[model samples]
Target: MLYGAQYYRPPFPGRACWRRDLAHMKELGFNCVKHWAVWNWIEREPGCFDFSELDELVALSREYGLQVVINTVPEGAPYWTYEGNEEDLYRTADGQRVAYGGPANLPSGGWPGLCMDKPEFAALVAAFIEETARHFADEPAVIAIDVWNEPHLEPMYDYRSNMLCYCRHSRAAFRAWLKGKYPSLDALNRAWYRTYSSWEQVEPPPRFGTWADMLDWRRFWLDNLAGWLKLRAGAARRGAPGKVVQTHVAYSGILGNRIVGGLGNELGDEFLLAREVDWFGLSSFPKWLMGPDHAYRHLIHNEMVAEAAHGKLFYQVELQGGAGKPGLLGGEVPDAGDVKIWNWNTISAGGKGTVYWQYAPEPAGVESPGFGLTGFAGEDTPRSLAASECAGRLNLPELDAAVRVPAENAVYASRSSDLLTFASERREEMYAGSLSGVFRAAYERGIPVRFLHEDYIGELAEATVRFLYLPLPLVLSERETEHLVRFVERGGTLVSEACPGLYRPDGLLDQEGTALGRLFGLGHREIQGLPDWGMVTACCEDGTVFAGKWYRQLVNPGQDVRVLARFEDGEAAVTERLLGKGRAVWIGTYPSYYHEHGFELDGGGKRDGTRDLLTRFMSLGGYGIIEKVEVPECESSGISLAPVVRLHRLEGEYLLTVVNHLEREARVKVWFREEQAFAGGPGKCLELTVPARDGTCARWSSSRR
Candidate 1:
């Protein structure tokens, strides 16, 4: 695994530190550095390509034994390339074209505008790529090409202009896309619920509206961006054949917002984009959003990128490296603890490498004061030293020796979920709240859980997925529903919450009632809100009780289904059903809300119970004999918070990592299944007393002595 920071050339005032920066990062255990090939800077004039600066950087990095990842910024073309082609400037919904660094002396002597889907603009991009490839192809230090950066048009935060790049060029491209999808105008009209007589009449929606059209518009750009990436990757491969080519995703489903024009920070379907590139990385800054909730959401983001890689481990790019500038997008500097946990959280989620955003603060820029590994004076800042020390510990041989396996608990995420989740920002309120509460609950209980997008659902059997948890899947297709049923029927445990499979894959309401009733053997009736901050109460026959500020629901359970609990009004609150050799559990109310918001909303008991519920749901898988973990001595030890423990199966061995977030030392024990002792003669009662706010990771094999 690689551990390092992004190395940007220093501004002119401190240009001398460029070489020093590479040297500093090298000594800090960084193996790689990425340089943004700002197209405008590389090609100052039309057809006159200059490789001087790029060539120097590559050669210099090679001297430091640092691998280089070059970003081909076709998304930011030089002004000269747009000469006599200013009409190609990306046009927004309101006909406002983003004009930054215009005419004469370009802003900072660079332009950041290009219509990615345009043929003429694409040719220029190809030329730049080919030239870059020819120049750096033979450079041993240049190891990868970042095929594109951010992959969206400019005026990113200008919400006033509406969603992005609705220029005639993109609209024509989208029309062509519709032609390919619908084949005829009549079919297109039927799908979009429109009366268009020809494909030419179709256009990207003016604004976010109607799931049918919004789906089409989003799908178009998602595919468009991916298609454009494929071309760019091909160009990079042609330019530097066999070099590792990768790209990155920016949108955090929970933390990120839709860019202007409804084209989000990520494509509608990230897997599609991943399919077009060699590998995928994501931008993660826990500070960008707040709370430990961001930590779990960040985990999901990392998992999405990992899934997109199709077995290739993912990376985290642009990690928080400095204190954010004080403003809307900035925040206070992250502490060593936050940085350490952030890195581990992503890695534990299966990231192969991580690159901090920068090695030093910029001498000048919009974000100059915000992000840095060191201060502007080039002195090692507290954060940089902490990052370097952290890097030294991670760039180890053992990391390479271990192979990451899927966790026991897997959450299902699909494109339908994303489409519905991102449809309206308001609709997304439930998404993070639900998943975070569940993830946090599982974390506290030490149940190894991870997110698996629908694309990887077929691998459930091979991954040894014992339990499957779906948190509010609002949409599902027939195929997806069938897959879920088969999974449950094949002896896999299942758990889901409200609105699971209630909507069709196409974003329409599934009016036929229960689309997934056959598996869970249940269907939801009307969901009635409790008036006057009403607290929904649930009591299980097993003597467990939970109450929350949540919605009340009525449910219909089948013959084999057993109602475990009900609302105060006598509606089904939770139910369990047997399917084949397996069982599925359905949670009726928004319990996670009770878990996360309870502390503030006067539902602490519900919050604590939710954690037990996550563990109980998995225990319902009906294992006659199973593994168990116990905190044997915590009360006297002053360890208040439960430790989070996870096991990663590897080739002929497994790695168990435990993070103790508590303030006091605590002894914990793990009893293996089948009374098996730990490998090499360790007893069946595997016990350890972890230090406060510390972590313990050990490699183990199942081969007992």
Candidate 2:
């Protein structure tokens, strides 16, 4: 199911064509296809409906052992249908109709979005779902339906002239929702910083406000969008019984778009999952616009899969299939093997399924040929053949099943922390895309770390090992603090940055001896800001030199607490102590901020030694397993490479995989965790083995057990 294609043709093609495509897909090892019905396309030919093509497509897919995920088109429903209908088509501050831009914006006009509050729009979607489901429900190939693509606060442009719906419907709904949450408008106004005289006087917060208010407003907008999605999902499920309904959420990354707001996937996904979406779909693009980093790309995709895999197994619904081609923002084209490399990386990172942004290149568009797997002519070119071959090899049942193993270690990052530190104006200059850098550093070194959202910290604590990288201030709620204490008490390693336990969830300053502080053998004091090149030297008790920005305690350590490293000023920078069988390490600086300078002595100097020391400490802490391998240049860039190891039991024989991320030839040295002897092998000693380049299988038998 991880191998699939995205089909963008207008309504179903003929039965013969459908059968041919399905059979071809099966032969190439594709198990699924993402099918879409664009909103504008459906609106174009109103009652002149065509189900022949859809019926045949479904039938053929079923016959060929392929699953179909359908997307409702009407994404850009025609403007004529709702132009004069109501003020519901995204209402602007000055109120004007949103225009639909041909293929670009489709269906809806301009920047405004289709009004979900409009009864007519809901009815239109319901009808489409009902009719579409009726035609294909009997086909075993049909697995699910994507309710919509990415829907955010109206469109981006024309915000002033056409603000979001301030119309009666939205106003009334917001009031009702607020009333249910709060008893009175007075309380609401107090929390929202509103000076409104009455419920009618209540208005959406102005465009400009304090960062705090902006954050809240952004949250409100996400709730609004989620409300709309829930309504649509409910209607669709009612119409299509026994059908899985879902939607795709495009990764805005650090964009802070209102659609995601502060909730990110936590609340947003919870809402969708509650609405009965069978599977979640995420859009992931990891390559930097400026340069390529294979290791970083792998980490980004891995984080995406880990985060999105909260519900049922997630799908990489809009994977980039090719490199940038001639386009508005044209750049270097992806090397021949880029597509295949990224695809396998997606799967290795826990993606249950993947669908390329496009199967064939677009003839004309803002990004015509930049993201398609197949060329415009739809032929199996070299790149296509390579992709096909990779898919064919991975289709083996064993490899597919081997991907289900849960990560051994979990790493937590708060969305709020990511927003505060990584999304700030100085982010690029300070962090320099090092979130992935740290992740890659750990991954390439064979660390089995999985990125997790803070909301899921409790779930992660249940894993073998849990690590939290809190670069920003940690303001914990009473419940969260309790959770942390419990996690540490039960033999977990809690690693935190400086200034943790400084603030409460409500943004009030936490008293010094608060819950987290006493547990970690530290106290919050004045936080000193480190310039980009400032440095603090920490000489470890073990004689290791550590240097970095100094953020937290001028540590006066308590009994039983070990000062692992200290500043040149003799103040502790890294401290470790045991509480029960559990352990805690408090790093009073952010090592993940590789691009920034730390506290120093009057002049600029790089302070990266602390980061290096902490990395080594964690590696030796038994937190993860590490190994090294040499991959030849041909298989190194432009393609994906993954060393997959499958173990049946703690003692059972396992399969090892060395994938080539190239188009033609590749030579690689696969290194795996040294295996200890089992009944069929030597004693408890660990050992490493390599398979020959041309060998399909290699076995290393041990002499004694």
Candidate 3:
């Protein structure tokens, strides 16, 4: 449970108060501090390395007994690297070259960085990281070295364009990647629908044309970014053997980069990137990025990253310290209450380390006068004091054993489905919304849900997930299809929305041939796409009527399939099938999408029965709410439709974290099952009063103990 804030990066927070700031941070209960090792700032003159300022910073950190994480910023490469290497600069799909200089945050210049596809420039970047790691390898205070910062392609803060690295070097690297993937020129030709005579004739698609080519292009970038991270991490490991190697993404691809034609095209896959590093995490500027709804998105974002880490050590690498916006238009400044809620949310999601973006306000550059825990004069604020209290609680010896992520219900996240949705419709809002809506429905009901990646489906036998949800699953691979059948056969319940496996992994339509037909006992012959905001009503067999938005799947069910619901046209809208010892339930329309829209119009006050519908299906899987929070239904602007309560199963005790989203104090009645009762306790319920817009954590011994 390492707690700290980012402290240095070349020329910020002036050197005059370095000693004082370090001592102050220690007094505030920060056990760790992070510093940037900018490539351009250190290697100003070609190969000659200078570590005077950074060395002093590390020494001061050591003096204050703070562990250090050396963050290497290759994006701020030396001016010399691109002076004679103009060809290595980033280029867009339209053949436009981006100039090299400092990005918004890095005032020292040298931005958009050099292209790693170019071998010569790549070596230089690797050399700088290796050198930086070796420089502080001997220091006991330097506990870890982060190879990359907010890993992404293209320029920072520039989401306007998705096309990146279309230079000659990048094209050559793409060809090499294709060659390795396809095995030969003929296979490449078949996949891309091209008739190339040789590998040299193959070129990365300049524009989106065919689905196969575009998906391959996107997949190539995902792998390429992982390869780039591998290079950086390898260099650091060579320089420092025992030190932890870590890298964090700007955001999870699932939540932030779901747009196929936009940010998704330019960002690295978290799953792939996590495998290349020792520890994986993400930067969360919720206050700056998400306003009143920051807590919900922040918690979900951390959960996604934790899933990406696959049980490995993950963190909130850059929690918002203060104001997040740039320059004169300062972003929302978080208060002491905000700090407590945000910090607890991170810890509840199994974040082992929490570090703010900075310790003091930016002294210069575009981000000046913002993003700091302390004032300009190095004085602590209420937010900083609240952070100290969180640190104290996190460092408790009981915490390591108390806070654990034990989720038995999960929603499926498919990289293939996301890409296919984007390629076919040119927008990812449908898929992204579905995932969000379904997760939100479960979350609001106090269900302990986490995301499950498609690639890890093979681990289902060993997984604890009882209820698996498939949201907007338009495409699924044959491998996934096989495992899903096995999963249902083994007494696991699966609930899926419309159009599951509408497209195969090879970008071919196969509704009848896939496991979807076998498991669900149904297939749709046609899908009628509706206009925006169009509503389609369905009546369930139980006399419950619910509405769905977007398209509707006209189901043609086979024998032995029970029709759970029907559309207005009397077509099967939802069906359930008994497969082996378990069941497969399918909704013929996007109910989750409709449920999401519910939150938008009236803060989820409108009950369309979708929440009850989804939760009822989950009950069949034995994954209902175990520890329920009893609270009145209140309308809210964001995802915090109700009080958020998370129960973690500890060694002998159950640790519960409750977050109140309302403006007024809440007297929450938390009810647990008889098996989950506390040892020698009065009853199955406990009454606790929580302050408005805040949270609290409590623990009790399990009756079994």
lDDT string for model 2 (232-277, tens) is 6776677677888777665433222221222322223332232345
TM-scores of all predicted structures? 0.89, 0.78, 0.94
The stretch of ten residues in a row with the least summed lDDT in candidate 2 is 256-265
Highest lDDT: give the candidate number.
3
For candidate 1, list the clashing residue pairs, or say none. Answer: 162-261, 163-260, 163-261, 164-261, 325-370
- lDDT tens per residue, model 3, 48-73: 99999988999999999999999999
How many residue pairs clash in model 2? Answer: 25
What are the runs in model 3 whose C-alpha is more than 4 Å off?
257-263, 511-513, 599-607, 619-635, 649-652, 668-672, 675-683, 686-688, 702-705
Candidate 2 to truth, TM: 0.78
Query: How well is each residue in 227-321 modelled by candidate 1, as lDDT tens digits?
Result: 88888888888988878888876644432421111234234345776787776788766665444444445554665556566666578866878
Give me the displacement of residue 217 in model 3, in angstroms: 0.5
Q: Which is the leading candidate under TM-score? A: 3
How far does residue 510 in candidate 2 sit from its true spot (Å)? Answer: 3.5
Give the C-alpha miss distance for residue 107 in model 1, angstroms: 7.7
**Arrange candidates by TM-score, highest first: which order?**
3, 1, 2
Model 1 gets an lDDT of 0.66
